[model samples]
Structures are given as C-alpha cells and as structure tokens.
Target chain A: MSGYFKRKEKWHKKYLQKDATLPMEIKVEEVSPQMSVIIPQGEIDMGSSGELRDVLHKTTKNKVQTIIVSLEDAGHIDSSGIATLIEALKKVEAYSGELRVVINTKKIFNVFKIANLDMVFKIYESTQDAKNA
Target chain B: MQKTLNESVYIQLSSNPKMATFLRNNVHKSCSMVGFDEEQTDMIVLAVDEAFTNIIRHGYKMDFTQRIDIRLKIHENKYFKIILQDNAPIIDKNCIKARCLDEIRPGGLGVHFLYTIMDYVEYTTINERNALIMTKHLPKKSRTKRLSSVNQQLLQTLLDIGRYVHQILDLDTLLNVIVNEVKNLIQCESVSVLLEDRETKELFFHTVLDENKEVANKLRGLRFDSNKGFAGKAFASGEPLLVRDVEHNPEHYNKIDEDTGAKTSSLLYSPLKVQKRVIGLLGVKNKISGSFSEQDVEAVTAIASTVALSIDNAYAHETLQQTIPDLSETNRIRKEIESARLMHQATLPQALPSIPQLDISAVCQPATEVGGDYYDFIRLNENNHAFAVGDVSGHGLEAGMMVSMARSCLYTQVNFSNSISDVMTAMNRMVCGSIDKNLMMTFLFAVFNTQTKVMAFANAGHPYPCYYQAKSDTWQLIKDGEFPLGIHEEFQYSTHRIQFDKGDFVVLYSDGILEASDENKEHYGLERLLKLLGSKKWMNAQEIQLAMLRDVRNFCESLFHDDLTILVIHFL
Candidate 1:
C-alpha cells in the first residue's frame, strides 16, 4: 500500500476542534514508560514550529527511550518544521535514545528528502509502524 | 481617476504573531476572488503568511506596537501583487538572501519559500520605509476575464488623465485641459467646477467652460452656500448623482439655470475629492443626446477625482514657490555638515603605526550623522608608545568639536605628564573647562613599554577591554573605571597594570558592539563576544578585528545606531 493510505484526516477531525485562533493542535500520548508519540495537526511553518519544538524538547527531557513525531494529520510542513525535528534528533542522540518521524504522504516526505533529513531520522508510514520499529 | 490594472484591497495590522491567522484568512478569500484553484490558493496564502510573519519577526523586531501595511492588487491584469510595507529601520537588501539550504537553519526558510512560490519577489526601501513586493501570475481564465472590452477603454482613458495629473501644474491650465477632455468624452454641453473656499465655507465657480461664451461669462465668480443647490447635495453627501429629469427632481436647485439662463434637462453631479476630502463639485449639464446614464455618472465621478487631485497639487505648488527662498539656506547648512564630516574623519590616523613587539589594528565607523568616535596612536618615545580610544556622548557637529578638542589636549598633555594617571587627570581638567557638564566622553588610554613587556592602562567610564590569556586559552575583561571626562576636575584617577605574554591579545571596543541586537532584540552580549574572541585566538590582530566586525554586522542587519570603534592589540 502507498504511504498516502495512512493519512489521519478523520483522526484529526475526531480530536481537534476547528479553531482559527490556535495555530496548531499538539497531542502527546504515552504508550509506555519508554516511548511517547506526539501528533501535531495543522500546517507546521515558522508560526507553529515553535510549539512542536517545545513539545519535542520536553519529551526528550523526560528520557523517553523512543520518541515518534507523527505528521500524518499535518497539511503542510516548511523548513522551520524540518529544523525542529533535526533539533529533536540532536537532543535524542545526546541521551542515546531513538527519534523517529511518521510522514503519510510523498508530498510532505519530499520536503524532508529535499533537506536531506530523510537519511538522518528513521521515518515510518504510520504511528503503529514507528512504534513497532 | 486613479488608473489601476485591477482593484486593490488594503489592510493594516499590528505587528504581532497572533495577527498572522487574520492575515491568512483575508489572503485566502482574496485568492478565491481572483479565481485561483485550491492548491494554488493554498500556496499563495502560505507565501503571504511567511511574508507577514517575517515582517513581524525581522522587520519590526517583534515590536508588537508597530504597524504593517499590506496591499493586495492585480498587476497588468495577469499577476497578483502583494505589497507589504513596514515603518521599521531600512533593511539591507543585500542581506535578504536565502541561506544555503544545507545549513539547516530555522529562520532562513521564510525567504526561500517566498522566492520558490512567487514568480517575482523584490525587496526595496521606499520613502525610508522597507517594502517587500511579490507577484504571482494569475490563472488563464481570470486573465481573460480581466481584459474585457469596456473596462479596457476606461483604463486607457484613465491612464491619459493620470498623465495630466503629473504633467500640468498651473491650476487654471490643468482645470481647462481636464474640463475640455471631460466635455468631449461625455458629449455634454458644458462642464463646470465649483471650488470650496475653506475660510468662508462657500463654493465659487472655479472653472466654467461652455460653447456659449455668454453663459460661461455669467457663471464666473458666482458664489453660494455649500448646502444650497443640487451641486451642494452631492458635495455634502460626497456621492455621485445622475438626475435624468432635473425639472421634476425635488433636490435639484434651479439657481444656476436662472443665473446663466440656459435650459438644463439633465445633469450629472460628482463630488471632487482628494485624499478623502471633498474639495469641490463637478457638474456636467445637458448631456447633448439623451439623458445621463449610470455609466456616465461613473465616468464623471472618476474624472472628478483626478481633477481634484491635480487642482490640489497646483495649489500646493503655488505655496511651495513662495517658500523656495527658505529651502536654499537649508541646503547650504547640509553641505557644510557634509564637509565637516569629511574633515572630522580626516583627523583620525589613516595608517597604523608599526611597533616591534605589538600588532595593532583599529577602525572607527561613524553613524549616518557625524559622530564623535576617535582613536589615535602617539609614539611618545622610541620604547614607549601610547594608544587611546574615545567616544563623545552624542552626535553631530557639537560632538565632533568635542572630539577634536579632546584629541588636541591629549597630544599636548601626554608629552608633558609623568604617569598615566597624571595624563588622565590633566585631560579631565581640560574637558571640564572646555565642554558642558551634560556632555561627557568615555575614554581609554594605555601605554606599552616594549622592553619591560608591561602595559599601564586607565579607563574613564569606558567599557572594559577583553583580554586573552595565551597559556590558559581563556578570556577576561580588564575592568575598573572612574567618571567619564568632563564630569570632575579634581577627581583622582587610578592606573592599572598588566603583564603581557607572547601571543597574548587585548580587544578594545565601543559599546556599539555589546549592545548590537539581532532581529529578536537579543543583544550581541558580552558572553558571545568573549566566546567569539576566545575561539579566534589563532587569528592575527587584523583578522580577529574583521571577524568581530563581521559578526556584529551579521547580528544587526541594519546600520549601527551609534558610532562603532574597535582597536585590537596583539603581543607576539
């Protein structure tokens, strides 16, 4: 199956309210003591990348063995968004932990590929796949 | 009439992060109105959002109180133009380049997105304000619709009228040319204009052109209350009105017809307005063929606007001609200041003096206005050399005079004084006697004895110099200072001594370095300066100074607000 098949549009509709005032919605789920999954829904550009960075920083500080940044519901991602993931990878490496990202579409995945970050982080098609890895 | 390729939407918002959402919403709606597809609209909105955020972040330096003006219009009927203007300090356009993508920096992507998505992107400074203009080509369907038959002619005619606005200056001549053009275009019997007398609050016949010279002669110099006639109703309401049958219209006043004794079956009335102020009334009477149509009203309203602006400009020109004598004196003073600035820069040493044991390099960059930052090297004797860097408190000719006064006194006093403290004390007395107490200068003076490998330095309320230790590979600040010069005459100054090792260095700079701030309003702090200095220990004196200057320039893309002076001395 194509990676686009795992898009979380309905999932975003179920969890996130249509709020124009808020830049984006970030939800963190602790699957276990050693792992945490952070789902960010909305366009991640300079305006909202700071929020994602803060969440990633906090999750890494907790000493989680593995952290997954799932952009399955994200509509778009810009350079700042990619930079935030790179920063998280750096912090995770300092503690000898694992950092993974879940991108559902080739369009957004190409953004990471263009930045040459796809080779740096372990990417998956779904949150379940990221967790399994 | 303002001739434009397409209608424009203007928006002004406070420079705040939260306002980005509001800006995006408006941009989406405007894109839709211009018939952009979903994907294209999203891309345009993304580009516009990045631009707005960049303005709030970089242009205004996160200053929430400042304002940003945005104008969205169609250019040449085929491209959508976005003009964003801000009142912040002028940006250095050369620094607006997108960083190399390999760098992976967080802040440089906004400019990249702007260039990638928009067809044409330009950064400019207009009227001392920074403007970012971007344009994207419209889709095919919208382009054809914009080039319809009727609006094309209207656009051409308006363009011609716009040319008149810039070409003609004499009020009577401009009015005559516009009136004749309006009469020919509308095919009307006569076109008349009534200007408002601001002092009397009345309207008088400013321009009356008609085929019947008798009627035109009678209408001249006719004055009436601004709210008494058909023209007054349109002028007061600031709306264009077309009365098809003026004989039956209740709002129509027959005063003009009675005065000129001309039959008026129909007429179009438009308020002549400029910059949102109703300046006069434009009347096109007796449409020669049939009654006036809605299209005629629109055409008359457009011409009236252009006419009003031309008249206002002519009036301003008349006033400006009366004030031409006063402007020449202002220009003369400006020239004198420029020459003084050149002379001020000439006083500083053009070349560094060579010493056997020391490598020294110094630079002084004045602000846009003439400033009082100076540095000098005086070889007192063969073995002993004296160096000094100082900045007066303010800018302009007064500060320049203070610098020269301090320099002359220093050269004379350093030769006669016995110690560094004695030199400072004598300079302090001279400053106290020469300048005002409010204006003081921060100065640093040092003397190096090449044979003993020791230096004596004193600070007069100046910033502490950064010192690098070659052995420990650590940096420290040589700190201790009393009042600045011109503050106290009898104050006893103290001198400090430091021993230099081979490969040791000291960097002296003005406060402009420490206080230079980035777009985030974060200063190029002392810690960063010390870290940078410590990292570049392998570089020579000139290279280190260039690196420090380049770092500060990168930190603050705009010009430095104050004078910047840096002097580096390396022991080898």
Candidate 2:
C-alpha cells in the first residue's frame, strides 16, 4: 500500500512537470465596441498564470465594458489560475463593467463547482451564450 | 621571452584604447619568461588589458593625452608584480564600486578580471600619484605541500564568517551581513545573493551589495529563470562557476544589464546547497584589482554553504514564530473537547439494573474525544424495562449534544407508550421538529417483559440486532426497519417480536463494529461478526461482550475508524 502511494506521487509529479512544459498562449479578439474575448490555449498554472492576469488587467484597463474569457482550449487550470480570474473579475467590476466565463470542459467546470465559485461568477456553456448575456 | 630573474621593464603610454593590446602583449611576454603556463599567461594578459582599459576609460575619463606609467618586476624569483601609476586625478577608493553581475552589461568587468588572475591587489596614493599594485605567486614544483599564508588567511576568514552567520537568525539581517562580508572577504567589486522560490523554480535577487547604492538597487528584485543565466546555471548544476570573462561566456544572460545600464566582467558563482539540494546562488563579481582566482572560488564556495544553512535556520525560526498562536489555540480546543468527553461519559449508565434470570452488559467507545453513539437503560416499572442504542450521523460536540437530547426524549416517551413502534414514531417526530434538516440519526428501541419472556423492538435505520440460540447453535438477524430518525416526520416503523428461551442471547450493535477497517481497508464484515458471536453463545452476557470487543480490537489492530458500541442481553 505504501508502494502504491509512492508510485502515485511520482506520477503526479511527472504530470505536473509535463503541464509546466507546455507553452501558454493567449489570444485577444474584439467582438464589438464594448465587448472583447480573451482565449487562453494552454494550462493556466503558476508558471503561466501571471500572463493571464496581466492580459486581463490590461483589457479592463482599456475600459472594455464586457470581457469574456473562453476556456475552450484550456485543458487544466490550478488555483493560481482561478485567483487570476477572480482578480480580473474584480478589476472589471470596479469600472462598472462585466466579466463572463465560457467553459465546456467538465473537469475544469467541476473545479469551479467544488469551490462554490460557479455560483459567484457568471458562467455560460458557449461563447454565444456569454455574448448574449 | 628569456629574461633575467631581476629584470624590470618600465613603459609610459597615453590613455588610449589602442594601448591595451600593446600592454597585454608586454605582460604576456613577462609572464612567459617567468615560466607561467599558457592558460596562466593568457589570464595575466587579460588582466593587464582590463587594468589599462579601466585607467583609460574610467580613471582618465577617455582622455587620450593622459599618460599612465606601468612597471613590471620579477620579485624574489617567486612573485610577478605589476605597478601602474597614473598622473590623473586621485581616484577615491571608496567611490569605486563594482557593478552587479546580475546586471549583465558590457563595461564594468575590468577591475573584476584583474583580481581573478592576480594573488594580491592594492591601490595606494604616493607623492600625489594614484598607484595600483597587483601580484601573482609563481607556481611551485610541489604545489600540494605548499599551504601559503594566503590560504591560511582565507581559511580563518571563512571560519569567522561562518561563526557570524550562525549567530544571526533574522533572515534580512543575516542576508545583508552575508553579502557584505563576502564582498569584503573576497575583495570583490560587488556581491549579490539570489534565493530560489521552491514552488516556481525562479531565482530572485535577495541582496545586491555594492559601493554604489544606485547600482545595487538596480539589481534588487531582479528575477531569472532557474535555467537561464550563469547564477541559474550554478543553481541548476549545484556547483561553483568561475567565469574569467563574462562577455565570452555562453551562460551569461545580459538582459539585466540592458535594463539597469550596469556592466559585468567576471563572475564567481556558487550554489547555496542544503542536503545536496540547491536552494539559492551566491555570486561575487569584478574583483577590484585582478580577476578571481582558485582561492577566491574556494572561499566564496565555503561562504555560500554557510549562507544556505543560515537561511534554513532563519526560515525555521520564522515558521515557528508564526505557529505559536496556532499551537495555543489548538491546545485550548483540545481542552474543551476533553471536558465535553467527560460530560458525555457522565451521561452514560453508571450501573445496570439487576433483575432475576436476566443478564445485561453494554460497552461504547468513541472514535474521538466526544462520541455520537449512546446507550441508555430506563426502568419503567417492577416488571417492565426499556433499552435504547443510537448513533448520530457525525461525531463531536454537536453529535454528543444530540445524543443527550435523544436520551431525554426516549426516557419520557418510552414510559408513556406501551408499544416500541409508538415510542420510536414519537421520538422521530420530536427529532425532525427540533434538529437541523441535514442532520439525522440511527436508533433502536426495545422493551422487555419479565413475565412474558418476550422482546419487542423497533429499529430506525440502525443495524439489526443479532439473536443466538444455544439449543441449535443458530443465529438470527432482525433487520426490518424504517428510515433513520430525524430524516422523515411521518415515517412509520413496525415492532419486531422475538420469544427468548433459556440460554438465548441478543446482541445490539452500531455500524461501527461491522464497518471497522484495517490498514488495507478491509472491513470486519457481518460474516466474521456472526461467526464470532455464534461461537461465544455459551458465555455469559458480559464475557460475550468482552470476547466480541477483544476480537474486533485484534482484527482492526488499533485502527478503529468509528465509534463501536455493543449491548448484549441474556435471558434465563
């Protein structure tokens, strides 16, 4: 049983190392005059969460009224990534703007649910639903 | 290159960029004549070029008309010495600060390169002229046996620094002292310490000490990827790096210099390792007189090891300080739990009522300080007696409180209702009305009639009571029950009837007994329990109860994960 736990821990460390090696890409697109969409295309972990936070802060600083974060291409996000999103939400709210998230991955969505943040933030099934909101 | 042992060469040159090559060649030839190896000769030539460049660019401020006098001497057939005297304005030794190596740039490495190649460096003012003297010891035939006075001094300095570092516990003070002492000990232009963030694998400049405050501040808070720069390389490889020329070194990262406008020339970097794991990097850059030598590397590496240990101690002290309040709070909570456990123990039945031809025994052990499992016996009259065993959903103060509440309610309702089913229904209604919706409990209530030799019981989601017949060596389980109490207000339960014969016994238990798991997660299931009880049917009620508990204790091996309660009644 101890051996099993040791093997499990080793696999977990390897998985985290693999996740850290993947390059993080963020794309910003202007959907309308008031709305902009930011899509992150990799794991949003400690190594890359700073980039997302910076991009979000910049987008809100530009006075965009509505910001949508699309996690369609994001396979995994840790607590640091969640904290960055929370910071972005607070930043947009201070400017009387709004922030919405669109997530389709069940695993990522379950994280939000478990933290009870799914109730706190506006979540949508697709980009169309978020844009409509 | 064939020169006499006492030969001395004196030259005067204008402070110009073109003079550096001529000076380098002259120094190379002088060193070759002294029997220096190729590598040693190249290092000597580089140090000479760097010194001339500094005199021309920084000391003279690029004034080509200024004349600098250089003297090369072979001293006592064992030391090669160079003396450079400049007629320029007297240089303030205090004002000469080496730029941070972390601030990788193009210009500041001159003085550092000079200290790397020479054994002794000094600047002095004599007759109103600024003179810089540098010396290199000749390589002896028996190198290993010659422990020079310089090595002894270095060792004493390292010991002093180690003692000083160990005496301090504050992280900031300790780091500041380390960087300053290292710069002074190694005679380097600047010293900077970079500590690793264990989680991110990033190195951040913790302290940058230089004579120039502006240069030092510029490199403060500078961060580098652990796999990027020379310092990072040292940390990654857990080794010391001696870079004689930073400009030609491939591992040098120049981004910091570009941002801060500071320069770096030579670098001596050592990894701060604890338990063979790299935790930080310590770098000394730009020796004031000559490039860094093997002795400088050895001294700085020793200091780096001490710095690692001191940092570890400081961190441990900080964590202990932070946890002091938390530890006190934990102690207070533990005391409160202990009191609650004692109160719950007080509520247990102190002595069982003795009746003719009946044996009754019960035992309950909580998994924590306070338990949710409760057992009570109420005497209704001379011929009637009521008994109950209940398990709340959770353990702790709230569950223990619920157990007391159930005991009070059962004591009052069992006397009013003659049937076990009516008493259970009433207790369920009271619990559903008073308790939180999320909380519920499993309960069993039974009443024995002394004259009729019969037992009537009602179970609400509790484990069924087991019956043993000594005449046939048979076992029977009574499992007919309703949903657990406090879950539904209108749920109905039917009374279970069993006629007791002589030498027959009934065992009432909570789920804790059957669900006790071992380290391998295998539970003590019902089959093992039934077999144990069947074999012990011939024993008295108290003995049978002890025998079953002992079996459970042996099987689980002190790995009880829940409350275990057992009530055994024998009829004669």
Please list the C-alpha lDDT of all candidates, in the order they appear.
0.75, 0.71
> How well is each residue in B263-309 modelled by candidate 1, as lDDT tens digits?
78888889987544677888899988878888788778767766765
Candidate 2 falls in which docking quality class?
incorrect
Model 2 DockQ reads 0.01
lDDT of 2 by residue, B1-572 (tens): 11112244455554654344334544655565456776677666656765776777678875554567677776766777888878788998876654454432323445655665589888887557888888988777413343345554554344334433333323454576567557757888889988776567778887888766577878887877878888777877898998989988776799977877777899889988654457778998888888899989877876787676565444433333333332456656765775576567556665466776688877766754688898888887788788888998888898888888888888788768767778888889877876467678899888888888788888888998888876787898887777799987888888887788898898999889988877587889899888887664355676667567656755664243336888999997
Q: How well does each candidate superpose onto the true structure, as a TM-score?
A: 0.39, 0.35
Runs in model 2 lying further than 4 Å from the true structure: A1-133, B1-327
Residue ranges of candidate 1 with Cα displaced over 4 Å: A1-133, B1-128, B135-327, B559-562
lDDT of 2 at B223: 76
lDDT of 1 by residue, A29-128 (tens): 9999999999997778666889998999899999899999999988777667877988888888889999989999876776666556677779999999
When only the first chain is scored, the TM-scores of the models are: 0.84, 0.81
